[model samples]
Target: MERRDIEIFLTLAEELHFGRTAERLGVSGARVSQTIKRLERRFGVALFRRNSRHVALTPVGAALRDDVKAGYERIQQGIDRAMAAGRGFSGELRIGFSSPLVGEIIMAAAEKFRTRHPDCAVRIREIHLSDAFSALRAGELDLQITELPVREPDLSYGAPLLRDQRMLAVPSRHPIARRASVTVEDLTQSPVLVPADAPGYLLDTLVPAQAPSGRPIARVPTLTSRQELLTLVSAGQGVAVVGSQAVRFHARADITYVPIEDLPPIEYGPVWPGGAQSSRMRSFITLVRGLRQNEDDVTRSHDHEPSD
Candidate 1:
């Protein structure tokens, strides 16, 4: 019926307890009950089944929950767009980024964007790759920077802004550190330290068919962040597979980054919600596209230079 009613319904549907939902919404239990009653009266249908112990969504309420949530999200997006329009292209751009390279590119582009549109504001949030898609879908993020070829039908992904090859990071003293390049089979005997955010491409393409079995020696799922993974590798706890950008960021004395010739190269790109393009978003995309072309030209020129 009303926005507040929808919010209350969603909250109650999730918590299924009046007191808990009220606590979460920072309202009184009586107010929450009153709101539900008003909603039911307006709809002429009961939305919840209540007992002394708990509350559960009725069949009609269960069906309505998703539709209401979608409607609320669309309404919120419209409000944000209206507010942004009132301020001109001078409004904030909330970007979601996953990989480190994406962050660097966005920072570089933000500087350029700001110089041209000084009144425009930029905010970047580093999120899990999986969460990036969901955040974009929910209208929380204006743009996303991630690996290319995003499969979601609701989103459209652009071409690569930059490409970085995967590298094997090992302790300098490790036996394979002296090699010019390594392969997945070469890592079979070593305990691999995987970053929780290791891109899907690496997982599908680089992991060995069978690691040398022995209690998995050391599986460090505890390392959630890239910094933590690098730290563990530097400590010689285990070897890690990471992007060249990561190696550039943390060139620790203990770890040596070697090119892995056998693995697939990684490419980072920009993604946005399908059918939600804006003038500001188009401007940012154009900037990134120009940057990518410049990078390609530089690479090509270097490739043509004579070898010593």
Candidate 2:
């Protein structure tokens, strides 16, 4: 069936009136009727039961309408992919970052990418970790930089751009900064600032709960962004937990990163839809993967030597 035929069906399904559908589509009512007739003939199914006063979808038509909507979405995506290829990085790339730390890396990469492909436009949005998967699935985001591996079946991800341990960000003079490593219990009674986009998997699954006294007191939920959390921690408002990458990004004298031995390692990577792939996406992934490798090598080199 022709695309216009499906469009006509969808418009009629929504309007439930031939005259309204024709007016909305900027076509004559007779043309609307003809399009619906053509669609029914092509599909060999009665799509709508129409009387002088009412128009309604049959059971078969209802099922077909649902499938047609999905089909139209797929067609639109295909057209988008084709247009993106034809323009060679001329369209806007909508990217989502899970936190400000990841945003920094993505912004840096975007700058470099734009220099090479100056025609391309980049728009970045800070999304909560909880909403990242949903946004991507809904086609609201083209790419996402988040902690991986993401659990959604409809999502796929490139290899990690950076992998680092979680650290406790405390005032430089905090007693915990003197330790080689810390446990969850070490944070008891310490006011902790948490980012709103902070992944629950990291906090709930990795960090242990309760002290030896069996009292849970390891969480504080006052801050929402990395900047806010770090600002508060720097001001001695409270301590906060962050990835090791935060140490590289911010080197304020008031805040220090303390290694946390018990927490799981965090992986930061690019995420995209499972079935969608494009040359631009592949190139972006390559750039991030190279950055991660370079960072890893530099980290390993530093681990073998003492600080000056």
Candidate 3:
């Protein structure tokens, strides 16, 4: 039998109804009957028992279906692999990500993507807050899935994949550490940690220069990396406004991650160079979108438990 006939047979075998199968296969019920009759005559046996209200596969037909279904799946998988290879899905896809939690999230999605497009290999590169845009603009990264508020004219970002509540990272010795929850106004008493050389908007996002009340929130001299920024917070030098993810990945003995009761949550998603999107990039984006739909609750067990 032809491949199309095999497909129709498999579909019909699962559906087990002439009219329903015909509707699914986009053919007439008469045509389905004709195919079954021809196949039975060729094999000289009744493959199905049918009446007005029922359609059931006979013993021989059931055996044939069980054997063919596995083989059919293998055949389809082979064809899909070949098609994926030809569609540029069989190449290296370099991805850049920031923050350890986001990295874990993206890598989890990448694993699923590799299972779907086995030929495509994904290599994740860690991005620093100071170098998020520079790496993308330099062609060093095909895509960077990071925190948003992307203002670059040449960069495009996908929809927010996940949102995390804003948390205030403070030294265990800081005064606010005694509070149940902190607000943007409290940071005015201490210098907020900032990443050195990051864009002004990003700096503002991380540790705003002023609170909603327009009181200036002073900053410690910019730190070179996220690790350095957190280290300073741990050392009682300053507070750092960060995301809930910090509790999972950047937990430190000297720091407390208190939820900022009044600030907006941080949103993250994929960002790539404008008009430079590739088939591999598109496939990765699709996989991330799927992962976003079924996010698993992550364990937020940190040593320094601050009230949410």
Candidate 4:
């Protein structure tokens, strides 16, 4: 079968909705229907059972999907690999980072990338709190390891490389600091401190403007850097929420990190421009995804281990 036909079949099988499959592949619903009908005629079997409300893969379709998915991925990888080898894949990859923890992780992946594809040069730069997406848009960096809620329509982000449980950062002398753990509502006591230039959506993601209990979280002064925020917290200016990475990289004698009972884990991932998926970006993303997958596999293995 043709490559595009295979892609159309695989995508339709996964979505199971003609409209959605069409939207995803940038084709019309009628086009999707026609392609599927053609494939069925060629294969001499019904691949999908469909009606006015829903679509479903027949047994043959399921078997075909299972068989075709892996082989399709391998083919794409082979093409990318050959493209890389042909181009000598020796270009500079600029990486942007926000936190030291993300910096450590992305840079580690960069080191591994260097060892494997020694032709490529990796450049790491610290991106400011307000410049996260701006740098990527400007093409100053090829990819960036930043926090989630990267909802810009022009940018694309990969699966998270790391997820850190959130904690509240407060002065060592604060009342909340003395507690073993605090709920998200406790932000009323100190308010959410964030960079003034941080987009409202990002601010909401980190520490919502209002707690689940409907109490508004007071806003404090502008912040430029994490250290500055920590300084303010240390001086009892206000409490700020941070990821667990702070416990390792930003621990200070004057500040304490207390687990937030209800906040979701902070997700960190690699993001790049939507249309600029280069050889370097794809390869680095693959490496980062592999690392996350291996970690997940080990965690699952441990979870399933038989206990004595």
Candidate 5:
């Protein structure tokens, strides 16, 4: 099938509604209908089972989708790489990371990117929570992999690259530290230490203002860095909620990391200054997304395996 045809079919397969597919593709509903009908005739099979109410892929259609999606992505990546080379993708790409876990992931992606485009130099730096967007806005960083819910008007972000369970970090001597896991309602019992300079939306994920039961969750917004936050928590100033990665990467004798059973997983993604994106930025995003997709696929496959 042609690229446009593949796009239409894939979109329809995803949406399962002709009207919504047309809306997504910015085409008329009749045009979408005609294209599917034409493809059905060419293939001599009904790709979709559609009537007045619902639509779904036929068995063959499902197989085709599974096979074509990866190839389509690879083809698009090829085009992007070619365009990037033609545009001289040799300039330095300055990237930032907010946390140690994200920093490690960025380093891995940078290695792959350098191997693929040796001429392009990749520079990595840490983006402190106290000054989240200053480096990006000032052109000091081309991109950053940080926590999600980036709502600034001048910034754009990609799909989440990493997601981990939220964990609470408290002093080792704290009463709740001995528990297997803690719930959101338990947050009311301790004051949460939070970043002093981050946006309220982001702070909410790390240290919510209230528990699920409407009880106020006291907070101490006095930290500028992860180490300082942990130090405060270790000193028994207050507890902190952080990504589960902290348990593995930031373990300390004075602090304890316990999973928050009731909180959502924290997400990290690429954020950049809003407007036209550079070829280098786009290439990096594509690489990270591809890596994340592969990891997710592997995890899903393992999840479905039959155990002895």
Candidate 6:
């Protein structure tokens, strides 16, 4: 099958909606239907079972998807690498960040990157939790520093850029706010507000399905933005587990940020599509690593110094 054909099939299989598949691929619904029909006829079998309201893959289609997805991804990666190599690192490098702290770091890196490679433009944007991987997959972003545990098969990640303590955001008047620290078990006292329509693994990291004691924690999928999440917490709608940086980035009079007594620190890192890295991307990665190392060294030096 052609690359576009494979893309359409895989996208339709994943989306299970003709209109959505068409929208994602920048084609019309009729085109998507015709392509699927052509593929079915060429294969001499029904690849999909569709009706007025639903679309589903047949057993043969499922097997084909499982078999070809990895190979197709590799082919795409090779094409990307070849194209990037042919271009020789003179175009815009798009970077994305998921949080304010990451954004600050990316901004600093972009400045240094531009200074070093004046010919290459650096475009930075903020990525949200709800639609984390789509932008990267759609080629809208080259790299993003997002929370870890990115288990996507086609993406690659690097070492942690920032590690921050996990904290619970609660209303100032709430009983949990009086505590010095809290734990996953404490989440049971109130519904935990989480980012809506996020991946399960990410949501699990922020707020687990069950605490250590096997008690179920109630989750309220109401968060859409940082401000909205904080507003909800301040209004006593629900509590949320957030990174320590929120204390500085999202300070509010009505909310108190309490550190989680037992949860591991949240780690943010660079995630990029394809296994191969372009020259511009590799240079930016190196710069970011060097800056982070310098910061760590300074922090350690300060910690061991004698006071006057």
TM-score per candidate: 0.60, 0.57, 0.67, 0.72, 0.79, 0.70
**Residue pairs clashing, model 1:** none
How close is each model in CA RMSD to the real structure?
17.1, 17.8, 14.2, 6.3, 5.0, 15.1
The residue ranges of model 5 lying beyond 4 angstroms of the native Cα positions read 1-65, 306-308
Task: Residues 92-166, candidate 5: write the lDDT tens digits.
Answer: 999999988888778888998998789999999998877899999998999999988799998987656677789
Candidate 3: tens digits of C-alpha lDDT, residues 6-113: 877776676578886786466888888888888889889988899999999999888878788778768876775576777757777889988777788778878987
TM value for model 5: 0.79
Comparing candidate 3 with candidate 6, which one achieves the higher lDDT? 6
Give the number of the best model, judged by TM-score: 5
lDDT head-to-head 3 vs 5, winner: 5
Per-model lDDT: 0.73, 0.73, 0.78, 0.83, 0.85, 0.85
Q: Write the per-residue lDDT of candidate 6 for residues 1-308, one digit (tens) a residue.
A: 99899999987886678986786566999989999999999999999999999999999998998798879868765664575457665779999999988888788889987775666899998889988889999999998889987888999877566778999999999988899998888988899999988889988987899899999999988788998998898888999999999989998889999999889989887899978777778778756755775687689689999999
Query: TM-score rank, highest first?
Result: 5, 4, 6, 3, 1, 2
Model 4 TM-score (2 dp): 0.72
Q: 27-95, model 4: which lDDT tens digit per residue?
A: 888999999999999999999999999899899998998799789869867886788888787878999
Q: Which pairs clash (backbone N, Cα, C closer than 3 Å) in model 5?
A: none
Q: TM-score: which is higher, 1 or 3?
A: 3
Per-residue lDDT over 177-229 for candidate 1, one digit per residue giving the tens place of the 0 to 100 score: 89999866666657777545445553444344354342232334445677777
Output the better candidate (4/6) by TM-score: 4
TM-score-superior candidate, 1 or 6: 6
Q: After superposition, how far is residue 275 of candidate 2 from its true place, in Å?
A: 3.1
- Tell me the spans in candidate 1 whose CA falls farther than 4 Å from its real position: 1-88, 130-138, 152-154, 197-202, 205-220, 302-308
Collision count for each candidate, in order: 0, 0, 0, 0, 0, 0
lDDT over C-alpha atoms for residue 232 of model 5: 85
